[model samples]
Target: MVSDFRKKKLLHLFNKFFDRDGSGSVDRKDFEQAAENISKLRGWKQGDAKYKETLDTLLKVWDGLQSVADANKDGEVTADEWVSMWEAYAKNPSSAYDWQNQYCKFIFQLEDASNDGAIDSEEFSTVYASFGLNKDEAVAAFQKMAKGKANVSWPEFQELWKEYFVTEDPNAPGNFIFGRSSF
Candidate 1:
């Protein structure tokens, strides 16, 4: 059963990033647009290595999402499908879904601009801002997610992400991953 707590966060994530076109479902075009948007946000031009890398990653992420979440094999993933698919692995992820873990690492590395193992408060909002999420909310989220630390390390990031998916506790720092938003 997908508890209401997990369902709320999953829906928030879906509405914010997955269903990028506000089309109620996710398709390749959404990933493509996200790639373009993130690339543009970073000033990465067409054919630039970074741009290409992000595009490829988003595309592959979509592929992985489809394979696992498109239960009807219809090429589009609905919010329910996405949430259900996540339910299968949210508490105990498997190696077969390593893409999900890699995706987190990708975001962490993106924000850790200094090539350091940690992300500072300012860098915390990079991806959220690209997704057009409120910057102030993202900063506030970072403050909460960081738990008073000056920076969030890769290990801490992984923990927070896991908490976001699996923890039902209302006060979990991971609950603030995407800042304040109603799903």
Candidate 2:
């Protein structure tokens, strides 16, 4: 299951662009505009090859989940029309492993401190630099092996992976929580 911290961060990021009116909730136009803007941000310029390519990619992604948003027989997506979109995205479906893989690759690119296709302590700090953590907190996480080594064991890697997406805290406010399951 996902962690509250990750949910909060995703919600914050989603709201920043989706909730254009600052109403804490996304409206119809906001969803389309946000998608368009995201397309533009991804090196898609008007009348450019990359623009069409990126839009096509987005359409492919959204079309597969059309029922989640194309609710009114109008072939368009709305804000309320995307309730399932966010939920599905947040749930991290097994079938969407490629999506998660892509995200991981992005993080790896940002965190590869050694720039050798692997993450170490320094890479993790650079990736999370925006947090502005003090030296002590940063050192604690690094010392604790928060970032996996060049050759990380499966068990050890899962722990580091969980830090960004799965909170171990039992009292966190979120729809899902992670822990040792008996089943």
Candidate 3:
């Protein structure tokens, strides 16, 4: 079972980011929009390889979400469904969500625009900003996760990403992973 706190955090992430276009549920359309936004941010025009790759990866991410979260097979993931999926993952993270790990890897690679093996606050903020999160909040989140460091390495971000999904502590830096949840 998921704690109320965890539910709140997960729902906040879904509503603020994944539920793009305020659809109230996440579907392939959200992934498409997200891919477009990210590709545009990367300055990869439509029909470009980078743009196509982003779309493909995001679609794979959506497929993973559908497989795990869309219990009804309705092609969309509701808030309840989303929270339930997290509950399952939290109970057995090691064995579940290999696709999610891939998504994280893609995001990390996307954020490391400089390809320097680490992600800086500017890079973090820029990518998150496309998700409609406040730039200032993204910066604060970077600070929280980076813990005063100038940049965060892959291992550190992996831990932070896991914590963001599983931890219920409001004060944990991972809570800011999606740029300051409303709850």
Best by lDDT: 3
Off by more than 4 A, model 3: 181-183
lDDT of each: 0.83, 0.43, 0.85
Give lDDT tens digits, candidate 3, residues 15-111: 8768888978999999898888888898999899999999999999999989888999999999999998888888777766867898879878998
- Model 1 off-target regions past 4 Å? 94-96, 181-183
Could you say which candidate leads in TM-score? Answer: 3
Which clashing pairs does model 3 show? none
Q: Native-vs-model 1 lDDT? A: 0.83
| lDDT of candidate 2 over 15-92, digit per residue (tens) | 543465666554455544644664444445667875565445544444444544466757554444444454555456
Report the poorest 10 consecutive residues by lDDT, candidate 2: 174-183
Query: Better model by lDDT, 1 or 3?
Result: 3
Q: What does candidate 1 score on TM?
A: 0.92
Model 1: how far residue 72 lies from native, Å: 0.1
Q: List, residue by residue over 90-153, the lDDT tens digit for candidate 1.
A: 7575443867886788778777878789988777687687788888888888888888888999
Q: Looking at model 1, report the run of 10 residues with the lowest lDDT sum.
A: 174-183
Q: Better model by TM-score, 1 or 3?
A: 3
Can you rank all candidates by TM-score, best first? 3, 1, 2
